[model samples]
Target chain A: MTREHLRILLPVLSLAVLLAAVFYLQPRAMSYFGLNLLFNLAIPVALATIAQMMIIMVNDIDLSIGTFVSFCACVTATLVQDAPLLGYAVLLAAVLVYAGIGAVIHLRGLPAIVVTLGTSFVWGGLAILVLPSPGGASPDWLQSLMKSKPPLVPMAIIAATLIGVLTHLLIKRSSIGVVLQGVGGNERALERAGWSIVRLKALAYGLAGLFGVLAGMALVGLTTSADANIALRYTLLSIAGVILGGGEFTGGRVSPIGAVLGALTLTLAASFLSFLRLSPDWQIGAQGAILILVLAIRLLVTRREAN
Target chain B: MSHITTTTPNRAAGLRDLVQKPWIWAYLAAAAAFGATMVISGGQGAGSLFYAALTFAAFSAIVGVGQMFVITLGPGNVDLSIPASMTLAATLALKFMDSNPSLILPGLMVAIGVGMGCGLFNFALILLLRIPPIIATLSSSFLFQSLAIWSNRGIRVKPPEPLAEFTTGGAVFLPNVALVAILIALAAWVVLERAIVGRWILSIGQNLRAAQLSGVPVNLVRFGVYVASAVLAGVTGFLLASFSGGANLNMGTEYMLMSIAVVVIGGSSIAGGNSNVPGIWGAALFMFLIVSMLNSYGLGAGVRLILTGLIIVTVVAFASKKGYAA
Candidate 1:
């Protein structure tokens, strides 16, 4: 296969192998309900992966995403149900803050990682203030919407497909996406071409923030409650997902469909581990191991392609 | 312009130069935090507050020094595994010691050994797997943390009695832990300012390709730095566990951010190449003091966190603006 085709096919193949392994390990997981049980938790993770992909598209990373999502969920559970306008207003302000952060990082040449690291604390703090003890309930509509069953496939799979297709169109096929990717690919070239680098960065961050909000809401929809540190692990999970999906750290290269698939693969890997009766303590370590294995495979592939 | 006025101008210039130093901001912030906390408490507990800040800041300063070196290797080169390394080292060492006083030395060795192993693993992943340091360290930390949890099963193993006393006790009016940290800082300063290895790190951070072409042992230097960072983290974990009377699974959780924050707030360039050892101490103290100030003012965790974030952002902005001007 051509390198281009291989590049696209690798993530798909990995997902297929992982899913097959999971099903093989637990024959019952082949059914619709079983598949839903396995993949349902991946929805928020996929959303988070897409969100991280947006930031990476601009050659930046968002360490605050996990906490930001938790904040959004907290707002959704508490204010969205009680004070709808305030809830949305707070989330909007948070996104604008993200945009402002992008603008500042671009203008000042500050490191996005450190700035986001600092903001993680802010988001965590805000989340706690919003819902101190995690008692807020998801709106009935959201819970029902998340629980709704589809005809053939599970809601999780449908949502994953929808996210992949929509983001592919928005980021891969749109003009704005071109500009955004340009900012990461060759920032100076984009600037020379009369594009405002700062504006492009802000737009990317804003969009990522929007996705983060979606991820949070989706998470709360599934869990039906929220806590300050609920989705804190999503930060690393999203980064790992993005990488597993064939995304590079510095380059503008990203794959929406691949990232979603990557998220699903990770979810399946967890289920696969459980099916193997692996100890819960090692589950996290297995995640790290999987990430290492996938990256190692990519390295070998790149070397082969070079030959 | 007159000859008699030259002395005054020289003095003014000296003050200006000192003010221009990036590390000075951290000290100023530290002092401000101290003063605010003092004011809030009606000038009470000044000595105790300073001592407390010193005690807590020591751990952050130690980890910050290690992180500073890694970050100095340049962009996307942070060691996110510090917390995990600390937890693992502490857990294993404490378990090995089993609270026996004679085993303290052996336990320290075990902690250092664990640190070296973690560092080696991190470096191997980065080199062999071609994984970025941030991602590599992050993933490896999960493994380390898992090891920690698996071995201890959430048990909090107590330190040997004498070891705990040594960690928590004061010597010559200074906390022993603070003294140990100061010694480490001094050693680190000597390395960064006087050693060839430090130069290699700085040059590499400035420009990797250029540094490589200059025949710098880039990989070796990177190997040493990563190992050093893990070793320092391991030592900090050991000390912290002893000082706190035991090791807990989540004991290292706060240090991950604490290390990075101290590095940045200490006025070290986040972009790498440039760094400050004195500033780490100042930033570490300021971090602790600021928390104390916020708590004394009856602010909730949310407000304290928000203020801390805003303060870090503002400091970084000002620091960067100065960097640009210089």
Candidate 2:
């Protein structure tokens, strides 16, 4: 296979392998009801991964995405239900904050990792302030909307597919996408071509914020409640998803479809272990092992291609 | 006219330069934090508070020093495995000691050995596997944490009396742990400032290609730094377990963030090629003081969290911009 084809095939192959392994071990998991159960939690994770992909595309990382999503969930649960106007305003401001973060990082030439890590605490604290405890009911409409059952495919699968296609088109098939990718590939070259790097980065961060909010709202809709720390684990999960999806740290390379598939793979892996009656404590380690194994394979493939 | 222009500008510039030094900001912030603590506590309990803060700062500094070693390796180098290593060390030490006073030394050795093993794993992943340090360390942390959990099995053991004494006991007015921390910092200073190895590390951080061309063993030094960082983290974990009187699962989690924060606040460039061993102590103290002050004022966890985040971002943003090009 050509290198380009191999690059795309890796994530697809990995996902297929995982799915096959899980289905082989537990044949019942292939049923429609079983598939729905398995993929229910994958939606928010996939959305968060897409959000992270946007930031990583700009050669930046957002450590605050998890907490920012949680903050949005808090708003959705409390403010959006009681006072829709204020809730929408706060959520929009959160997106603006992300854009501002991008601007600061670019203008000041600060490291994105540390800046986002710092902002994570700010976002987490704000979430806590908004909802001190873990008991805020999501709006009834949101709950019902997320619960909609389609004919054949599960709602989660449909939503995830839509997200994948929409983002893929926006990022891989559009003119502005070229400029965004250019910002990561060679910032100096892009600047020489008279593009404002700051604006591009800010735009990327804004998109990340928008997706983060969606992920949060989707999570609340599924869970039917919100907590400040609800999506805290999504930070690492999304980073892993992006990497598993064939995204590199320094390059603008990312695939929305691959990310969604990666998210599903990870989610299934966790549930598969649980299905095998493995202890919860070991599940985290098992997940890490899976991530390392996949990355190791990818690394070998890339190294061979280079040679 | 020339003399007047030169003198006026030179004086102003000198003042600006002094104020611009990152260490000065750390100390100023430390002073401000302490003053606030004193004011809130009505100065009656300031002495005890200061001592307590010193003890806490000493622990943080020990961990921070290790983190600084890795950060000095250059941009994109970090050890997320410190917390895991620490937790593992605590568990191993407690289990080895088994509440027996005679086994303390052996337990300490075991802790150090575990740390060395962790360092080796990290080095292997980064060098042999060619994985990025961030993800490599992060994944290793998972392995370590799992190991810790598996071994701990919800068991908690009290440290031996002498080891506990080493952490809590003091001479005249200084706690033993704080003294140990100061000595560690002093040793670090000598190694980084007065040793040949220090120069090699600095050169490597400044420019890897130039350092390699100049006959510096870049890989070896980087390996050594990771090992040293792991060992130091292990030592800190051992002492912290003794100080806290037992070992717990989440004992080392806070160190992960605090260690990085202390390194940055110490005026060390996060991009690497700089060493500020002494500054780490001040920064550690400064961070501890700020947290303590917030706690003393009865601030909520949310507020404290926000302030901590703001402080770290502000310090790193300002400090990294100086004496270096972004």
Largest TM-score belongs to which candidate? 1
- For A139-207, candidate 1 gives per-residue lDDT tens digits of 888888888899899999899999999999988889998778888899999999999999999999998
User: How far off is each candidate at the interface, as Cα RMSD in Å?
Assistant: 1.1, 1.5
lDDT of 2: 0.85
**In candidate 1 chain A, what residue range of length 10 has the lowest lDDT sum?**
A1-10
Candidate 2, residues B1-326, lDDT tens digits: the string is 00111334558777675566566667777878999988987887877877887799988999899998898888778898899999999899998998899998899898899999989998988898787787788778878888888889998999998888888878766788888899999888888989999899888889989999999999999999999999998988999999999888899977877888788777888778986786788788888898888898899988987887888789778777874552
**Compared with the real two-chain complex, what DockQ does model 2 have?**
0.58
Candidate 2 ranges with C-alpha deviation above 4 Å? B1-21
Instruction: State the displacement of the C-alpha of residue A110, model 2, in Å, after optimal TM-score superposition.
Output: 1.7
